[model samples]
Target chain A: MKFHWFAEVTYGHTTAEEVKNNHTWVDAPATMHDPLKVGKTYQMFIRLMQLADRSNFDGLAVNEHHQTSFAMSPSPNLIAASVAGTTENAAILIIGDSLALYNPPTRIAEEMAYLDCLSEGRVIAGFVYGTPMDSTFCYGVPPVELRDRFREARELILKAWESPEPFAFNGKYNKLRYVNLWPRPVQKPRPPIWVPGSGSVETWDLVIDEDYCYGHLSFSGLRSAKPVVDGFWDYVDQRGGDTNPNRMAFTQICCVAETDEQAEKDYAEAVNYFYSRQNVNPAFAQPPGYRTVKSIAHDIEMRGASSLSNEDRMRAARGEMSFWEYDEKGYIIAGTPERVRQRIRELATDLRIGQLIPTLHMGNLSEELAAKNTQLFGTEVIPYLRDLWADQPDHWTPAVSQQRVNANMPQVAGVAGN
Target chain B: MPLTTQTVDDAQIRVWSAGSGSPLLFLHGFEQHPGDAPFLQRLAQSHSVYAPELPGYGESTGFESIHDIFDMAMRFRRLVEHLGTGPVDVIGHCLGGMIAGEFAATSPHLVRKLVLVDAWGLWIDADQPADPFVLNPEQLKQAKWHDVAAAERETSIAQSHPDGANAAMLLRQQNLGVATKFMWPIADRGLSRRLPYVSTPTLIVHGESDGLIPSAYADEFARLLPNAEVARISGAGHLPQVEREDAFITAVETFLAK
Candidate 1:
């Protein structure tokens, strides 16, 4: 099982001018080093990795974004490369390189291959179609076409990685006359592939069909994510696929300290920095046009799906809407190490998920606070979860392995086959 | 210098200013705080505009106790008196306009000229009910009981620049939580009557599609004031400064120039 600590590299500003006008945009370093260079941004990822290493975490995670102060790792592969050298043991997981956002999937495949080699086989690659508001506008791609393009991109990359030699393929988004990938991954076949989603039903089916790790990024709230995950499991059950709990993972914020009170106090500040400043941007979330039809439909379904009264919806929306304060019931967990462990166990059992990706370092959280939380979780919470569910063999594994293989797979002749 | 902040008792009150000219105090919308940015900087270039964080809004020191818009206006008047060294031109946006209107009505001697930008005052027929876009069901239900406090806020910045990036930033800066709390069924229906007592030169600029406080209401506001000029900024909403910044600015600049 691979464990990862996710960092968004978030910052809160009163206006965009503060970001655009500031000198730190160019002067600041992406990697953490000197205090004078602490860009509130690079500091976020640096803190995450440092904590991941200190806590014996399997990997440290970072992501990509454009034209926003959100987890500013525009080129996540760069951060992945930095993490490759920064930490020795922890696998550097780039929770995404938007395949659709990039013009050619080969760029992503080649980069992941290089990153796999760089990490010495410790690379967990994540693919995602861009979200509305950010990636859609940045790439100038119409939202309607994103899903088809994404699928085409994924197929191309998979062929590039798994195929023996250069091949040719044709699709709506890309056409390759010669398909050749250099420096194939260190791991046989390929490094573990994880697709991050926000409840796209089609994505769930695809993940299950391909036997790839399915990750649900519960950025909104746990209750909000129920229908989405339920949909994923339903698809798995329908296919008669052996449901490996480890096949499912959830990304949520978790902070643990010596005491519940201390954890709450420290977590509140970071939470405030996130909800109050960063995520509150209406532009960050307008309407879904970036993912597959199922994901977009799921989001649309949830628009009026929850039975919460309009007043409650408004409250929930307002509660979860800001970039300044903590959403008490949203995607975060803040408590003592013991309490955190129990909550994780309950969530895992209730959500029926196997692996858990906790975002411990978030929203301007200090290095000290992040490191302490990591260390405490490693020492206390992890053991408690393992001990509490000691009887369940299914709960024991890191990453669940599937026994079935795609037998009699067709040969990829050329662009015509795609 | 443009927008600046000063921490008062843990809360930070941001202030915006421009050229070392006559003071034109510009108060932002209901949920916003003053900050260093292009919008404030541009305003500062013409008149020495002073935009401050209202009590209980933004980073400003929140009200020590529960208070209404009138109570806030009283505090704002005090803040202006304390901050201004000489006669000043006063301006307000949305609820800020109401506060500025009330302030000018009450303390006519302190202000030389008054510019109310889509200010909220006077109980318009109540016939229209409230704007749906501004307040959702949660606010209406919660408003029934004063016990349930409104949520904390981060104001969404308005981006009017040609580049889509500013628009994108504007979307991110939106803090509906603050707006929910700052907004309430307004009281103080006497603003229309009090307008006759406002002795200062006044400019009333409004958006054509201001559903919350319609353009008709802006006209009525101007009609009541003995010394007033009324103008409509086309293709704008309640947030005319954002939707029609060029026209909004031109009206104010022309009024102030006169």
Candidate 2:
């Protein structure tokens, strides 16, 4: 199994009262945060990711969101560049740049190529149709046109990366007379592309058809994700698509410590802070045409049979659940190395997930605690889990970083290291 | 009133038609078509009223071919020609008002007279309009009617249909989704620039209390049109035709008579 160190880059200074009083996304008041503090937070993330690199995580994942204290990452490429230039072993997994938000998508082509060259081919390109709040509300792209714009941009970028010479391109959304990318990618046919989605069948078909790695990047834990992930695999298998576990990625919020009591003590408040601060106004969550009629029907049907009840989800989000309740329902995996390892192994084996993007840091977590969590998971947990899916070849991540991470992994007690 | 499917540009569209005299094309607002409303029935008494559900709206089939407002205008032109009508009077409301403005400007030869009621086609920076899509039911009620209590009587999307409530919701979503093509963010699709080119005599009617679109926009639309005048309906908000039916009908009929 491949592990990626990921975090939401949440602003750490927000108080519980402040979180309760306001919605955390799209129109969240900016006055609640200090710019200098945000800068310090960025520096803190860079440091934590650097530590993750040294500790032998396979990839460092970053993503883009807009107008949200929940993430605070507007341009993930900037963060990706910081990690790419600094880290030597981990893939700079930009879990993505919102393709439709960028005009003349050659900009994405050029930037991804620059990162690939900078990391010496340690870049994984991720293309996404950003959240409705980000694309339709914040960036002002019409929701109806978002998917079309993303597909056009993707086609343009791929052609720009592969075309040997400058070419004239005519597209409905963009028209460039001369299309040429100066800094071509280090990977022969550009970097491995990953597309993260929220269980839309259209997305499943897209990833399966294009052979791109599909990531179910929700922090709602295993119970929330199982139905959708299982449905995805079923859809893939029925279509006769590749059933390799390596093509799937899942996100989980994780907290690890010396003992289970220590884990609860250190992470409870922060986990509560994480869940409570993500109260998006329901109106902005799903705009018209954001999800198709078929997808909406499918979601309604799937959600009706889900293990996580509406009350459970609400309680989890409102931080009303106990720390163990959160863990029991799979909103998180928190405990000592042994318990975390057991739960994660069950999660990966049951879901058949090869790429696990573990969120080690969450809301209001201290820099020191997050670093320790990253260190513990990297040193103790990852080494033991490497053998779970070693037989399945992973073509999702860049080749050089995979080899480097495998070569540099630390030897665990009684287990043969990768 | 009768509902029929008409073939235009190799795509089928649902159209509602009734009455006699000269042809008049009635375009409904952003919500669903105010199906067989009293105002529509009254208008059909004096003029041959043809109200087609816009492509991709309701059961209409041609939304995929419409790339922009120009394409939408062309689709309307094809529909009009297929009806064997020459240069008909056009009345458009809300989102339909925006499309009607585009149609009048682009196909000046086809529209004899134009009426835009609580239209959305211009963006005035200082008097920015409220976003219609984001408003909740209560907020929308407050924004769309001068008398909030009267909003419960509004029948824009509540008309009885063969389909159940779930299908109705789906239809509502589908209609609003198509509206986002021109109305998302700000409703301005450079209609202010094209308004001057519209040779058809135009009447810019607005609800005095429209929170979705302020009265200043109607003034701006009149200011931009080559031949136009403004009529304000009191005790109304976004849907003046429903709020002050008699006044709206009088204003439209008087303007069309001229």
For model 1, how does the per-residue alpha-carbon lDDT over B110-160 read when each residue is reduced to its tens digit? 788899987767666743435322344365334222222212212233323
Candidate 2: tens digits of C-alpha lDDT, residues A1-418: 9999999989888777887798778889898899999999999999999999999899999999999998999999999999899989999999899999898899999999999999999999999999989999999988878888898999999999999999988999999999989899999888999999998899999999999999999878888888999999999999999889889999999999999999999999999998887768887887887777668777877787688999998988889999899999998999998888888899999999999999999999999999999999998899989888889888999999999998998766754322
Q: Choose the strongest candidate by TM-score.
A: 2
Q: Give fnat of each prediction, in order.
A: 0.00, 0.55
The candidates' interface RMSDs, in order, read 16.1, 1.0
Look at candidate 2 and tell me the lDDT of residue B4. 88
DockQ of 1: 0.01
Which 10-residue window of candidate 1 chain A scores lowest in summed lDDT? A400-409
TM-score of each: 0.54, 0.97
RMSD of each: 20.9, 1.9
TM-score of chain A of each: 0.80, 0.98
Model 2: DockQ vs. true structure = 0.69
Local accuracy of candidate 1 as per-residue lDDT tens digits, A375-417: 7776566544543322334322213111110121112233111
- What is the alpha-carbon lDDT of model 1 when measured against the actual structure? 0.62
